[model samples]
Target: MIEAVSLTKRYGNTVAVDNLSFSVKPGKVTGFLGPNGAGKSTTMRMALGLDNPTSGQIRIDGKIYQDLKYPLRKVGALVDPRWVHPNRSARAHLAWMARSNRIQAKRIDEVLDAVGLTAVAGKRVGGFSLGMSQRLGIASALLGDPEILMFDEPVNGLDPEGILWIRNLMHRLADEGRTVFVSSHLLSEMALTASELVVIGRGKLISQSTTDEFVARASDDAVRVRSPHLQRLRGALTDAGATVHEVDDAIIVSGMDSANIGETAAAHNVVLHELSPQQGSLEQAFMQITGDSVQYHSDLDEAPGQVLASGTN
Candidate 1:
């Protein structure tokens, strides 16, 4: 497991990470989420001891990263895929990492094949595309078969196929009882990939919970009711202490479930065409929770199609 106890970091006058604390357990995929400039990268850096914390501490299995007998064997990370030397071949790069950690050279081929880079093992990293570079970085991370793994935007430049590959790979690693912590801006993908979430904003911890719990807490219990007797049903629902709103000919009832709405309508002799519960999506919940923390905003009032046409000569 990985634990952060009030981890903090500063760069001169600016605070990069602020007293953040969280734990990552084995056999689960934990997604680290935040908006741009949210200090996610800095927190990950502190976890790996790449940057010393201004105050507080982070421990990997009860030991500081710098004190590990073989750090790579205990924790593997892919914070920046571009950290490799441009002039080195993918095979050479892994070989160097293996040598530094006193890992066997035979593990190089195993990891290369594990990440689907065997065919391009001899190719120079400078010539590799972003997706290929990401694969190579993952291969390097797996070189030691560590018990803990961390990745930052592992699917950044990947196509659909590559994205699916990385997602499955993370799941497999976690199933093998490794601690997997990943950070990404893709909320939809994170929803599908992560079992737990650690959310932060502006260098502070916002939430730490299971994926389902986080979504449920951020969402309101709402039911969608459609009926010809819109007026009567609305009155009955409101009288029952439910908030009602109309949207596109449908009545949205909150503070109640579908079963309650149906029963309420039946007792009032109001016919119902449809009654469905509307659970908030991860994307919707994320937007609601991080609305104020978003550092970037777009001012375009029109749709993208309209904006593009207006800009055309």
Candidate 2:
């Protein structure tokens, strides 16, 4: 298991992460999600002891990462794929890492096969494509079969096939009872792959919940109603104690469900044109949770169709 308590980080005048705290347990894939520059990378770095925290603490298996007897043997990480030397072959790199803490060299081939890089083990890393390089990085991390594995954007440069491979690898590791912690900015992609999520924004903790709970918490719980007699529907809904928002000519009622809305309209002798429920999407829930705190570019990215519909409303 991985635990972080009140984890904090600062960069001179700017605070990159503020009192952030969360735990990652084994047996499931936990996704670390945030907008760009929201400090996800900074938090991961602190957890791995690559950067000192301004305050608070992070530990792996009840001990500080640096205090672990064999760092890579207990915790393995792929922070940046570019950390590999371009001139060295994949096998050579793992060989040196093995020698760093007296790990057995024979295990090198085991990891190489685990990540499917055994076929190209003799080739210089400089000639490997981005996806192949990612595999090599993962192979290096698994050399020791560490209990805790952290991946930072493992599928950033992968093709669809490579993406699926990485996805399967994460689950396979978690299935073996290893703690798998991964970070990514792609909500749509992570939504389909992760079982749990920890979301951060503006260097602060926004939410920590299972994927289903997060989606449920983000749901509006409002009912959608459309009618040709829009003005009458609004008046009736207001009189019936339902808060209403006008969507173009349609009325969106929050306090009442479809059945109640239909009955109320019928009692009032008003005709209905259409009454449809708009089921919220994971992307919608994410936008609602983060709101304006999203640090990355593109306002349209969160929910493009909603934006267009908003204008019509």
TM-score of each: 0.91, 0.82
Which candidate number has the best TM-score? Answer: 1
Give the per-residue Cα lDDT of candidate 2 at 211. 90
- Give the per-residue lDDT digits (tens) of candidate 2, residues 76-194: 89988878899999999999999996799999999998888888999999998888888888987888889999999988788988888888989999999999999876777788778
Clashing pairs in 1: none
- Per-residue alpha-carbon lDDT of model 1 for 253-276, expressed as tens digits? 999888899899999899889888
lDDT (CA) per prediction: 0.90, 0.86
RMSD of each: 4.1, 5.9
Candidate 2's C-alpha runs over 4 A off are 223-255, 262-278, 296-313
Identify the runs in model 1 with alpha carbons over 4 angstroms from their true place. Answer: 239-241, 246-249, 301-313
- Please report, as a residue range, the 10-residue window in candidate 1 with the lowest summed lDDT: 304-313
Clash count per candidate: 0, 1
